[model samples]
Target: MMTSDNERARLLPSAALDVLGNDLLLRCASYLDADGLVQLGRTSARFGIPQAGQERSLANEAARQRFRQSATEDERSRLPKYDGESDVGLPVSLTEGIDLEADWERNINPMFVTSSYKSAVAEQLRSQRTAKWGESNVHCCTYGCKDGRCDWTDWDNETGSFDWQGQEELEVSGTIGLLLDLDEGTLSVFKNGLCLGAMKEGLGGEYCWFVNVGSLCTIGISRGRAPN
Candidate 1:
């Protein structure tokens, strides 16, 4: 029986040809790695139709990967660490003096606040309407020591970062002051002056949001008088 690698090599040529015929020899080249492209170039040369050079093949693959993995605007801003001290302070309390009843009424009733600050919050809530799920893929987080230093501490400490997958439900209100960014087909939410979570597009055009919360409880997005 043919091994998996052999099967792949045998099948890849036909697949590549079907996708990229005489019209565009570089079309299917983006899917191939260095060695695969080299083999493909050899096959093409055998047929006297060699098209892509080594540099062009490598650059195309790199470009495709970059396009696939590029982060959204919101994601770029909400990184794990900041370069300098931020003007914004952490949330005094997740839930302390928040008028849950009033906030709920405002959230559900769609009542407009007259105060400038309250209007700003309401505008933010309106902005949340644009938040949508982004690309989804298997993300692996490795926590281990490297270069004789503790690289795993970020995932080991109590307040350290952790990896998550799937739709994340968040309990946020106007009083909580959460920020959401939806750009480059990705969604990143920030709360309490920290990185709350991120979402990316997945298979079948579905998006998954992953959040690492302190406690394991059901979380959902609330905006525009509806819970997301």
Candidate 2:
């Protein structure tokens, strides 16, 4: 008697994920960055792998890893989905109201270097940018600044215009991540998984998510993370 794929799946180990037991698989998954784990979960689901419990476990563990050191139990309990929609402390502007289901779905790039964010990089960059440009003219709303000016690129001498570009558009090679410090009401940029600096406006007193969509110059919160 031949077994159906579903039956075989039930009777045997997972198809590409075989060598790993559920707990072991989950443990390995715990090491993945939030985005990586999410992508893996999605891929697993699409392949008919039932990892609901394991995925939840991975997420819980990741959340703990993110907040275990600094957050109180209460704050940990209050952590919302990194999905960018649950900032309870702020007004919901049109940008914040936009659906971010697709934006947060970025695949974990192969180049990412996993590391806990440090405030020093962010502060240093902010100070440098400020020294060079005076103050950040970026106007971030509940979502974030979309005018492409937030992440300033090259300044054109002929047009006297600044070229705004997302991290991916830069000539340098690096990975970008969003660092949200809910306890501090701060949102900072992370480059290659390190803090670049805090964004000046449209943050604080509320949790906000940021992203750069469409063009190199486009910067806005699609209602999620990885603020540009």
Candidate 3:
């Protein structure tokens, strides 16, 4: 017998697909995987090859184009003006600030507690970090750590320490805040407001920060000496 969480997890993608229909669902599911449907897609008998076919049908050109045209107008009305520039100077650290916390606490927090999509992404990030760095203390590595190793220390919950080196004072932009402190040599990432997860340099100086908030995940790095 499937648990309620399992059943709901399996049904979520399907229900989302049902409401968004096949086309939008496919786009949404593209960011997701089979395990993204909770364990239901894997263990439940209700989901199978047919659902996969339905997902593919939504990916077809006709469906995609139709959704795109309809969605464009709908999205325009719903989405606020972005002004075509980064809102870095904005007073709030992220989209989830103190003002938005009340609504998020009531609505979004519950979903994160129960949603399989959140769990899947979190697990994927955890695995990726473990595989890449082994048991080392995860740091931003924004400076010229060419070999991908740093002398930073991890944070200790019990005994706090001032672990900052001269490198920490180097003012770099595009980094929202520290997610995981390197003083304690643990893999825990703090997702509090203004605090983000570990960021590592990707191909071509691109930086990726693992954020549960979705919007704060990708951060572009700019290299330069600290401003005097």
Residue by residue across 180-214, what tens digits does model 3's lDDT show? 32343322221212322333312221123432332
lDDT of 2 by residue, 136-179 (tens): 24323222233323432112211122332332223333455556
* Candidate 1 segments exceeding 4 Å error: 1-23, 28-53, 56-59, 62-153, 160-228
TM-scores vs. true structure, each candidate: 0.20, 0.26, 0.21
Off by over 4 Å in 3: 1-36, 39-43, 46-99, 102-133, 137-160, 166-176, 179-228
- 186 in model 1: Cα distance from truth in Å? 17
Q: Model 3, residue 226: what's the lDDT?
A: 21
lDDT of 1 by residue, 151-227 (tens): 11111112223344432333443112223332443333333334434432222222223223344343344331112
Q: What is the lDDT of residue 72 in candidate 1?
A: 45
Candidate with best lDDT = 2
Give the candidate number with the greatest TM-score.
Answer: 2
- What is the RMSD of candidate 3? 15.7
lDDT of each: 0.35, 0.41, 0.33
Clashing pairs in 2: 122-196, 122-197, 210-227
